[model samples]
Target chain A: MSRKPVGNAPRREPIRTRWIWGVFAVLFVLLNPWYFPAGSSRLVGGVPLWAWVILAVCLALSVFLHFVCAVYWQTGDESDE
Target chain B: MNDSGVELAFAGASGITVLVAYGLLMLGVGVITWLANRGLHQSVDEYYLGGRGLGVMVLFFTFFATQYSGNTVVGYPPQAYRVGYAYLVSIPFFITIILAYLVFAPRLYTLGRRLSLVTPVDWIHHRFQSRALTTVAAILMLYALANYLLEQFVAIGQGVSGLTGGTIPYQVGVVFFIVIMVVYSWLGGMRSVAYTDTMQGIALLFGVIMLLVGSLMYFGTPGDAAAIMAANTPEKLAPPDGPGLLRWLSLLLLVGVGAAVYPHAVQRIFSARSEATLKRSFIRMAYMPFATAGVVFVVGIIGIAAFPGLDTAGSEQLVGRMASALANQSAIFYWAMVLLFGGVIAAIVSTADSVLLTFCSIVSHDLYGRFVNRDAAQSRQIMVGKLVGLVAVVVLVIIAWYPPATLYQIFVLKFELLIQVAPALMIGLYWTRMSRRATLAGMVIGAIFASALTLAGLRPLGLFNGLWGFLLNLAICVGGSLLLPPSMAEQNRARELTHV
Candidate 1:
């Protein structure tokens, strides 16, 4: 149920290939609850410890996307014209 | 699905006044835009895509306003209340939408500029050059967008009636907003839609944030809410177990991809004035889930302690109930809650207007222009699209007025059928060998399979029916593309068009 989505993509590498996508795959998996055992249900800062971890994962994804959009991603020129 | 039992003291006259003011503001934006760009309505490009000249902020807010509809504000908290900590998946899923966009948007944006792609199906017809594939893709988008519009109409009626304490009946409220939305949309087209979206998006964000603050002030702190959950339903506070985990992952996949490929969203991508403008807008969008979905999640969590004993059906009215509870606390909160509800209706119309515009563009550009009369003038094409959209609005308003019991199934089908187009649209963007036949086969079969699963209320293996259908569609289409031979001429033409 949790396999990485390695859809049958063509390997031509048109858009800049980056390690960030691999990083996204890892971050996405961590965002789910499988990695965290439910027995560790302690509270952290008044919220569930696991929930905080999930929020942190989401924040990391957001930060990664911010970085990706600003730096890693590049659409071709003449798109402005 | 009963009412939230919200009856504000000033819900009658003040609510209507705020609504009229908001409507007039939208019309003002339309009039100003129309006057500024008076002669641009002759072509679908100018009328529908805002002449391909939206700057960063307008593009960003329009994307925001269109993507996160009134439902996100009014309807999502009840869901969060029911799901508990597990609903935190909401934020991550929104981020994943940008992930979906990153896969296809960069290249699609480039090609859209070069080819003057007007609708999503415009891209399909260009890529595949198959009448069947293009027509089917157009039908799928039209179907999905129509269902989306119907939901907005229903929401507008409910929001208007709810906010005015039934001073405005649901039908009158629906008709009033529909006329307002159509007028502004017809007057200034996409420019008006984007400007009004900026206003609506700001209002919605402010209202949601205020609601969050009032909820925290009235209900209690996160600590207090946590203590209540620990004492009462401790399971809510824990990480999801096996099936729940599957469902979470499924949601991240389905909603993220489905929304990213939305027709209005695709149009927004094309409407960006420049590549840099689109990039900057997307960067902002990458962060919005935290404010909108994240805040709503916290509000829903606070509700656990605020109102404890309601069953599932009653909990559906949670946001309204909390606003009502907060309004009782203070004078300022009462007025703030009124704006929140008003903003909810505005956001609904904002979303509906965007959908209606895209629906019309597809009718005008893809279906009518391409098929009925290839030589027809652009003004005539736009006119036909507006007429058809008006007819659709009329019929859908009827359905909203006396919604059938099976309407929920139709609501669910929007995403189910819409996702079927993603394989064709996104994959065909890059893969040179992407076969039109395979794509058509995959899209049609996947739609049927997903519809059957949804109608039967089946989610085998804790996965969404759309996800299942999408996987099968992807496999067949991508697999078929891999196996089949591409026409070299077609391939070369695509490479020249895309330059990848």
Candidate 2:
């Protein structure tokens, strides 16, 4: 194990990192259900419109997380013992 | 009588058989893991964390089992039944937990591996070097874990009795599964827990799939149910009002933060074999909400139409009602319902065992080993922890036998307190200037505030008490840290500990 401090080591920051917070805000707005006061009359592929909105946004969030996990979430693996 | 009582009276012989088979399978896994790692048992790291060698699959399933639990299978449908489409918050809330991890897990995993940390308190002591802070953190974790274990115990008892009809009493079922769990965990520790977690996760996934298919085959899918609910109970299908939205947002933040900082989940991060493995597991975890929580949400919506006119109390028995109805339909469903019930029980046991094992590790390595005998052999430390764990479980079971007001309330209570620890854990990882004194104050104040509000039955506009606690926790942590800077030595130490 390297006892040297890797704390200040420079690594490439993912370009999408800056927008992650913005994405979270968007999800929060979309998922809050209160804004879309629609009833069962409006349907998307059989789901209530409100529910379909939440589901689609969540699915999109999951895909985004996958991309972030693969490309951006660095854990200093280069410094592992 | 209630639907649970009625279901218990008609529990089938096949369900009991399937339950026993599942129990045996868990035991067999434990024994195999124990034998494989016999030589490594003397070391705390080996027993508690599988020598930090968990691959993506093992880590993923263990994470899956720990996060989803039996509650997701049994409890969630009823919640969906009661709230309608609004309960779909469960799906995003679960995903948000993964997002919460993004804030700290990568850094912590790197630090944990570098330092060879075994428990959450280990990081506490290393970072702060404050006995007061570490002690408070340990006690809070223990209290939350014990509360969590109690819920699983009660659920196990109810699951067994209900699944078997009245053939097996609740007490007998709880004791039977508890004994098997303790024995295997004692033998194999985290390896056993993680391996059994994999099996339990698979069982739960299969069971939910079967239950959903059966529900669709007999009654209908979520779409069909939605159409019926739209006609009969439009409110169930409509968007939330103001207070409802408040509650939904509060629950989403509470679970996202609270579950992310769970001691067991943190330990899993430390236990990953490599950063690559941890990343892979989390990547998989990000999508699991669709397969796991999404399915149950649909099943619950199905229940709203399949069994309409169910009040809140009546809705709690939605899974039992639906499963029993399906079991009566045909032989295929009869067997599938049996497996489903068995899977539920196994899932509960899997979760309880992980909590119990983590509980033991904390007591063994953090409290007794740290304070009582710093020089005690690793084997001796683990033995003391095991003995303490046995006593703790006994007390918990006695309490479970006469459970407090409601199981759901106890579930909420633990989260209220556990989320208080999040500020300290998350901030301390990244902020070198966070004062230990401030962290301790945030925890103390946050816990007291949250508990007080919950006990007073005050929601403050339908929001959960935990969110109030977390807000205070974050505010206090930020304000206190800025106002009361870390001492020079403390700042140096923080940098050292958090260094990648």
Candidate 3:
């Protein structure tokens, strides 16, 4: 109870969080296997090249998000000051 | 399935060495814990909860290990392999955990500090003033956690068998890590788990990076992978459509919410050293999916072209088979392959240690101290918790040895049960009107519904998971709270506590 609030104390906005999550949800819908054409692909070395690309993109995106989170999203705790 | 003589011997020797090393480390951890907690600071708060002093890095990694280990590495690849692009949902779903926390964690963190809340049950006990509700929530949390620990045990055995090419028997692998984990967890409590998680997390990251590099070198680029997939099966590259899209979205919702509520994870929030540390760590963790999920997904996708026509079981073995193939190709590849194998084992141990610690804390803090021996000294509570943890590990190892059914199926069941606690943790954070009775009723009904549907092989319409049970759970929690008025005393307490 002794803790004082910090920062601009961004107005509690559940809606904004919900919308951002919605965007990710939409992206998830766009990314799955149902849209892809079914059948076998010829092997390169040993794998399908497109699949590898998707994996790379995912890896890149995940790393990018972690950096963003580390740098931006975090607000210091109230107890720190 | 050919068991070459030389390969078998090499695998056996490596496997034994890894298990022995793991055992010694765990025993060492236990001894450290005993020494640290032996005298003046032997309270439950110090031992079970690490004196509530975890910094952001330790807190984040502890949470990360609990969520990502075992299944993130072992089970997820096969899913990615089977569903192809649809499994891309895994990364976003994981990122959603931080997003979900943003919804209420700040408030909860503040509240936790003020109340000295040791567990999620403490929050419930304070908010609702209902013993029945707190008890039910505690039992449900215990069941979900034990089931989760059991799955880790099962994974340890399978991971060891696969990594070693069956050179280590399943029973030996299960017992080996279980013994190690129990010893260390009993030693330093959360401190030991967190310290070791830092080590485990680093190994998993290094191993996965090495695997990705090795895969690209051995196979080729995505362009190459794409050309191969296009010729063999073009559908693997296409984006999801219709029901596939629906299922993907459902997966995102189910796992995002489900994973965030795990008892172990909630406990980590309590362990944070300062609010700043928690925030910094989360910001860092918000991006971990790239290293953890991103790497596993790449490995799975590459498997598409590298090894084709694999059945479900065969697909699950993709990482191991791919590693084995590469190692056999050259001397350099062989050593790199062994490191990757070691990394995978490290990931499993890291996960097991964290789960075991959380499991012990729950028993010590919630069950025994709260119910059985209410006035027991702090040291006594720690003793009961550690003993319960040791017993639980033994039971789980027995189950792992026999393995009543499939590993993945049991793994899925763990999430179904754990996700039931979401309403109480996520919703109760801000909403003062959420009555304890209502929360309990919703959780119980949801748990029963989820368990029944899973056992009956029922999927609500065409949804891929039993989290449909959660829908009912949420509805009951919301509806019951609104309908049943909170006692005046309860309302006053909530207002006083949550006031900003």
Candidate 1, B107-212: lDDT as tens digits: 7887788788888989989888899998998998999899999989999998888777788999999999999899989999999999999999988998899999
Off by over 4 Å in 3: A1-81, B1-10, B29-41, B405-412
Mind giving the per-residue lDDT tens digits that candidate 2 earns over B75-185? Answer: 999988888888889999999999899888887787787788898888888888889989999998998999899989998998888787757889999999999999999
Candidate 2 deviant stretches above 4 angstroms: A2-16, A38-41, A78-81, B1-10, B404-412
Model 1 TM-score (2 dp): 0.95
What do the candidate models score in CA lDDT, each in turn? 0.86, 0.85, 0.70
Least well predicted 10-residue stretch by lDDT in candidate 2 chain B: B1-10
What is the C-alpha lDDT profile of model 3 across A1-81, one tens digit per residue? 345547656434332355545654554444343434544243444454434454554445445444444443433355562
Off by over 4 Å in 1: A1-15, A78-81, B1-5, B406-408
* lDDT over C-alpha atoms for residue B236 of model 1: 81
Model 1, A27-80: lDDT tens digits are 988988798876456887888888888888888988887787777655444333
Of the two candidates 1 and 2, the one with more favorable TM-score, higher being better, is 1
Note the DockQ of each predicted structure: 0.33, 0.50, 0.27
lDDT of candidate model 2 versus the reference? 0.85
Ranking by lDDT: 1, 2, 3
- List all candidate RMSDs to the true structure: 4.9, 2.8, 4.0
Please state the error at residue B252 of candidate 1 in Å. 0.6
- What docking class should model 3 receive? acceptable
Q: List the residue pairs that clash in candidate 1.
A: none
